[model samples]
Target: MLRKVLECRRCGYRTVCGRDDLVARLRIVGQLRRDKDPDESIVEALLAEYTPLMTCPGCKEVGLKANDADDEWDDDGDWQAAVLCEICRQPIDPERLEFLPETKRCTECQHKSETGTLPDEDPEFCSRCGALVELRVSRGSGITRYKRFCTGGCRGV
Candidate 1:
């Protein structure tokens, strides 16, 4: 099914809307402008009603462009790169993706998740030494409560 979606140009965030929903929203905004306040302009009413939908959920930026897209081929048909495992940050298997396109985890991660053996957090590696980085609580009164440190003790290198 083809549907209309509002996409943020800056952050690539998409908000899907059906034709009936869009029409209903426009009607509501028009009624609000007519019944509630005649002084309120149509542009003001539209912006007030659609500012949240126009704003990118990921980056909180405005300016959304409308586009018609198929449900299966959304995001410009770049399904392989678009779908990634939430746990391992790897591309999900194409077969599994075809079967369940909305899945967030890959097969291994999904199995581990279902078995309650999935790790709480993925291990971060140090850029300098390629060793595991550990999250440590800060002692001083800083903005961030926790900071990542290299386990191999590569101090500020």
Candidate 2:
């Protein structure tokens, strides 16, 4: 299973795709490797020909390049270099990023969002962390409805 990314030469749009997934419908399934067989040339060509059609609606090949997507990220402390918190615009600390690299909030903001008491008024997501918002609505006897977050479970960290 080779995980890769395809970059569009026209617009530079990138998308993650697996080699197996890309070649599944290409009619070449018996070329990867067997018990102790050596690498095959057909498999290599199929992987190299992975096009940008996986993400687009139609076929397009302006020069689809295959790159190891997994190689883009590592736990080598570089991803934590510097990023702005989407909530309070605070600089993220590299030390804290070791665990929560995708966090969009600082420690304090994350805590507030978890407790469901974020300071921002009527925040759709976490006011401090900018988490996903789960919208909820209830129906009454006849016709009673007003857009609102039903409860604290509406937002997730």
Candidate 3:
């Protein structure tokens, strides 16, 4: 387990590891959390409560979600802006950020439309640039046609 800290700039939420033998201990807990024991229920309950993060109690109260990173600003020396993709909710590829700078979809999710599958968003041209728009569809009796590419463009990137 590599050491990493996840701090939310939105609500001061912070999850720090290796603060106490974190790596070595986390390795063992993975298996035990799967055991069919009563404690396993507790583990699931706690994890469900926190979801992606453990907790700082106060931070959860403010509802400073990971999505809030869209308006993200650095809160401190170590904390940086959120880089999670709006579509897949995963870390946007650092390389994509290098190229597009404002990419909100992970590469896989972004390419879904390219593969002829429409994403959940409405079809329209990219708001920033009138690039080749993602394909949106309308189903028919025996075929599908382009309703439009969902709204918005390449994010001016």
**Given candidate 2, what's the lDDT at residue 111?**
82
Residue lDDT tens for model 3, 101-148: 967678887788678675555323344554435655767777767654
Supply the global lDDT for candidate 2: 0.52
For residues 39-85, write the lDDT of model 2, one tens digit per residue.
34554566666443233323443456667766554444544224545
RMSD of 2: 14.6
Q: By TM-score, is 1 or 3 better?
A: 3
RMSD, every candidate, angstroms: 16.0, 14.6, 18.0
lDDT for every model?
0.59, 0.52, 0.45
Winner of 1 and 2 under lDDT: 1
Residue 32 lDDT, candidate 1, scale 0-100: 31
* Residue 58, candidate 3: C-alpha displacement in angstroms: 18
Instruction: Report lDDT (Cα) of residue 116, candidate 3.
Output: 68
Residue 117 error for model 2, in Å? 50
> What is candidate 1's lDDT per residue for 1-157, written digit by digit as tens?
2245667778787756544334433443233323333232443445445645544547867656665556565645444333546666555788998999788889999999889999774456666765667878988875869878888788532
